[model samples]
Target: MAVPGCAGTPPQGPAPRGPRRVPVSLWAVPPVAALALAFLYPLALVVQQSFTPDEGGTSLAPYTEVFASESFRSALTTTVWLALGSTTGCLVLGFVLALVIAFVPFPGARAVARFIDVFLSFPSFLITLALLFVYGTVGMANGVWTGVTGASDGPFHFLTTPWGVLLAEITYFTPFVMRPLLAAFSQLDTAQLEVASSLGARPARIVRRVILPEALPALAAGGSLVLVMCLNEFGIVLFTGAKGVTTLPMLVYSKAILESDYPAACVVAVVNIVISVGLYGLYRVVSRRAGA
Candidate 1:
């Protein structure tokens, strides 16, 4: 006795119950277990080794000895300054490039953006070598200058200095900053920019107010990444042969491989791991907040 709408509709069968979902937390166990085995276990082993003594019990003697050495102190200072300088340089240059690629209209703008991606795939050491050819005293600029002026040395001695390491670090890491920044820029609301422009807001003002606000997250994330990477950078500093620029990574290598001071090397390595982990945590927080 079904009515036109529903009054007398036949009784339907019971609704089919879908299979119960396993809690997502349960599903996450395997990956979490794998990560613990892969990462945390290794980290724990390093920490344990750092504490282990030659006589075979826990001791802080390694850390005490390593930190007491002036060479360790000098290497640490070099690591910190290099990380900061290179990160700052990368952020500034990368942000500007990202702005140009994202907002400024010009020929081959898209092509330039695509080229930035290529840099990430390239090995950082190659950039160091290329800089050598361009600025290493006997390289092109110097070669031309020497041929023209009969100079004994080229003006481009920075390549052999810490500043050269800085330059190489900046060049290699800028693309890291640019990649995140471009992604953030792409998600920005163009309408706001259009409105600002229509309202006669100057380009710099528009950038300062409308753009920079949205970019801070990417900046934080990228800068932290570059800082962490720079702290561990061995190839550029080593290849540049920069005098007195031994970073923690280089020191760790020298201690473990050359000097065979495993405990001391472990001390330095553990410190680096702590710093990198702290910065990475900061990066994760900022990136999540920014939805980047």
Candidate 2:
């Protein structure tokens, strides 16, 4: 004696299970394995080579010799100072230019802002080359000076000096700072600027109080990126023909290619990688905190 509805329904089995699905994390394995093989493996080789000596045993002798060398010390010092100087210059110059492009309403301002993106794609060596044309020994500046003053040699011989490298780095990397700044600035409230202006705040005061606070994160990120890039820069130094400017990367090139000192090259490369990775890690932490 089954009830009309309750007993009419037979027992229902469990809902149909779909085909076994892979865990989401498992999908990441292929890419991670590929990365390990492609990048991590080579980096490990370099690290291993850095520890290896010409005598063919794993030891720190190569590092000892390389670090003790005068060239390594000079290159390390030059690399640090140049990277710091270029980063400072880029931050200052980029901030000012970005401010003008973002706030000062002028004709072609948008065009100029857009041009920064294109500027970033231009190779670093191109900027060095361009600077050479304008400031090289017989370039425009020297040519004009020579033609006007009738001097045998122009006064612009600094093109192959450290200062020239600094200038080229600033010129090439400034746009990197500016691009992030512009993005940050775009999100800034126009109303605040207007209110500040109406409340009798001077331009400089408004910038200092209002604009700068909002821009600090972007500035920090941009500056960090420029710092790392400057640290690793080889093309600009090489193209500038700044024989005097032997940075870490340039030292690596000379050691590996010219001297055939693979162990020494690896040692310099490891140092550079450590610095770059440490800075990058710091940047990530700072950025995360800033965002929070």
For residues 1-292, write the lDDT of model 1, one tens digit per residue. Answer: 5565587677778899999989978988999999999999988888888887677889998888888999999999999999999999999999998998898899999888899888899887899999999998789999998889998877888988899999999999999999999999999999999999999999999999999999998888789889999998999998898887899999999999999888888899999988898888877886788687
| Local accuracy of candidate 2 as per-residue lDDT tens digits, 163-239 | 99999999999999999999999999999999999999999999999999999988998999999999999999999
Error of 2 at 129 (Å): 0.9
Top candidate (lDDT): 2
Best by TM-score: 2
Candidate 2 global TM-score: 0.93
Task: Estimate the overall C-alpha local distance difference test score of candidate 2.
Answer: 0.95
Residue 16 lDDT in candidate 2: 92
> Candidate 2, clashing residue pairs?
none
Model 1 TM-score (2 dp):
0.85
All-Cα superposition RMSD per candidate: 5.5, 2.5
Model 1 lDDT, residue 184, Cα: 95
